[model samples]
Target: MLTELIEIIKDTFLPTIVVTGDTALKTDLALDSFEIINLIGILEDKYKIEINVIDIVSLITLEDICNYIANKKMP
Candidate 1:
């Protein structure tokens, strides 16, 4: 899941950059407000889960996104 999430982030936002689990979505990648909004949309569609707007602030790293999606996903 981590690898796949990395790929999605790469394809959607950072096409030429390599992102790791510890990479900060905002600090390291410099994702702005609009980009974060777009990321939420892409993540919802790709993962088939609904992400609350309030959770956006908690998603600070790639690992955070992976964990959040993992919890939201049905078994």
Candidate 2:
């Protein structure tokens, strides 16, 4: 799941640096507000889960996003 998330982020931004769980979405990834919004939509569609705005705001690192989607997935 983490790998997939990293792939998504790379696909979205085409980052040239290595992305890790500790990488900050805003500072490390340099994701702007628009990109963040787009990411939320992408994640929702990819994971088939509704990601609320509050949840989006709470995500600080790549790991947070991976864990949130994992927890939200239907069994």
- The number of the candidate with the highest lDDT is 1
> Per-residue lDDT tens digits of candidate 1, residues 2-75?
89988988888888987899999899999999999998898899888999999999999999999999999857
Count of clashes in candidate 2: 0
**Which pairs of residues have clashing backbones in candidate 2?**
none
RMSD of each: 1.2, 1.2
Regions of model 2 farther than 4 Å from truth = none
What is the lDDT, from 0 to 100, of the residue 46 in candidate 2?
88
Measured on C-alpha atoms, candidate 1 has an lDDT of: 0.90
**Structural similarity to truth (TM-score) of each candidate:** 0.91, 0.91
Displacement of residue 39 (Cα, Å) in model 1 is 0.8
Q: Write the per-residue lDDT of candidate 2 for residues 2-57, one digit (tens) a residue.
A: 88888898888865779989988899888898999999999999888998897788
Clash pairs (backbone) in predicted model 1? none
